[model samples]
Target: MQALEKRLKREVLQNGKVEILASSSWCVPVQSIDVTYQPVKRLKMDLLMKMTLLTFQQAEIANADELSELLLVEELFIQDLLRNLTGTGLIEKGEMYYHLTSKGMMQLENGIYEEEQEQETQQLLYSACHEVFLPVDIDQMDEYDELPDLFRYASEEPDGSLTFVEEELIEVLQNSREPEEEGEEQTVITEILSKETQQINDIPCLEFILYDRDKDLLFARVWNTLLSQWDDKLEKQLVEKEVVKWREYYLKA
Candidate 1:
């Protein structure tokens, strides 16, 4: 908790816009689930989009009325498509014509059109150790520190306790996400089957009452000791889990 206090004073107090009112400690269990899902990938553009862009490239410069006749699509629909294209800055609309912008030409050069397709939507345990709760995703950090046992997954029934082989289950998510392909939409996970328990670790936290004098607002934020950072998502999760109460509950103090 020393780390939490030092960080809060150093990072928060220096800002004149905010001040720390009070703080309290609490323990929360965070679960790590090895989510396995089928990765369905596709480009952001669909067939019509590809056709529209190609039409622009072929015709070089054409008005919506001309494009509609050339593509054999309705003029109104073509107008909508052209409007979308211009809105995204891929194409520019001239006094009376629409043409592919340099950005649109680059998309064709990058093989984006070739990959156009459809996609659908898709969708840890806690252990208490030391005074600090370590996260199962500790592997994400560069420094392992000195605690070798922190990484080891406990065997079933270790020391006759409740078998700490990544104990318990909870609904939580960690990014462990894929690299974003700039401007390209990727496949979404429809559902999550299950996650293998890597290890059980506790998430120790300090809830700090923050006052934004500028806004005249008091809010609650949880400082994650394990991650050594203020995790807004985890703070919201804790509030949802009732680990932290509403601001009114804290202001009474």
Candidate 2:
């Protein structure tokens, strides 16, 4: 009994919630039927796991400070567990923090019935991605710019093909090329870009370009028009990895 107590105590220290689930009365049985019953009788143990994970997920929602306080684990430990959970699609890591993955959140909600909390978490994540692509006036930047060259320069000018460039080089060139007359009145160009008119002639395409601006030649263009702004080869790799992750998350037993 002393040996078993030490073992259980060690396990409880390793997983804080284990102590909460362990019932004192369960005893090892000599019969196979008793052992079978023991396995089936672990519903509370499963519940404890759900509650512990839900608590950690809630801490993530509340913020990093709360997470640190509530989880009682070292920062490094939390980071490792979160990384593993994200790799297994049990969590999602964003620019600033982490959240439960779709399946994780769904399981938590179904297991806990905390609908409002789950919806709030989902909205927060969705809004973060949504704001990234929303129409914003680029002219709002100090640099006064235009897209006439982009449209005129396009190899095949589609009606809505005047592309937007977020590359700093193109932005600098546009700003520096200004005819002193604009006098920092750049927002006009921004207002035009903000319209997102989308008509063949009126709507301009936008690309968030990033590269070494010092190069004299514009031989390579990184267009942000695709679902992910990456070259074909890089995009293929990303797609394959995403597919593999999806398979692991949904198709694996």
Candidate 3:
């Protein structure tokens, strides 16, 4: 039993990098280093960047103030980190929000520099999405218990209406669609939703509900319907101009 105890103590000392184990009669040195340390600023920056990237992975846009609150850091510190990250092309500032650029996404998926485990990443994704995308008054819904916070691109209007981006894209698509017969009108949301289900290229479609303080609207589209059509040029244009207008209406003063 004494031998077993001694072996366990040695294992703990080696694994923990502990320097000393004191006995009643003497102090025995276990390892050369007594402590491990990292610069406080560096540690803070590393954590900030990781959390920012994870947040961006879930939300289309994030701002420094929001990030600071989420990371429990000073707003000024987060702003500096964001500026530096933007310069490196890991983050892109869109109007009043910051988005994770393609480069940042690549680095995250490839496990560059600082990478979290798969399960950890998934947990972060779920939490971030819920934080940013779920309706603020979801608990008030009659079927709130049955609702799951699924991933989707949406923005909350100043009037409290949740607008699905894909629904806007669908409206655009519907307007541009040419009638199959002469003088025929384009398909409308009512016609689309009245059907049992809708599909594009054989892929199943999903319905999105835009909930407001007073009303709820239903929209239908397949996953990636809008994303697939958005090219780099269009994305850039939206980020530079249209997204600003969106922010103006969606974000409160």
Scored by TM-score, the top model is 1
- Ordered from best to worst TM-score, the candidate numbers read 1, 3, 2
Tell me the tens digit of each residue's lDDT in model 3 across 1-253: 2343354345434523232222111111111111111111111234557777888777655577777777788999988877777766787877766778787887666544331211200000001212222111212212211222322332222221222344533343344334455332222321122111111111111221111322321111122122222123323433454444444554437
For model 1, what is the error of residue 120's alpha carbon versus the real structure, in angstroms, after optimal superposition?
24
Please write out the lDDT profile of model 1 over residues 1-253, one tens digit for every residue.
4664677777767768988877666554444435444343446567778888887777755577787777788899988877767776678877855677887888656645323224322223344322222343545433323222221222233321332321222112223345576767664343344544454444456667677878867665766656767767655554455424445565556
Give the better candidate number (1 or 3) by lDDT: 1
Worst 10 residues of 2 by lDDT: 31-40
Candidate models: Cα lDDT each: 0.55, 0.33, 0.37
TM-score for all predictions?
0.36, 0.21, 0.26
- Candidate 3 steric clashes: 0
* lDDT for 213 (candidate 2): 27
Candidate 2: where is the Cα deviation over 4 Å? 1-66, 109-253
Residue pair clashes in candidate 2: 139-190, 159-200, 160-200, 162-205, 163-205, 164-205, 164-206, 164-207
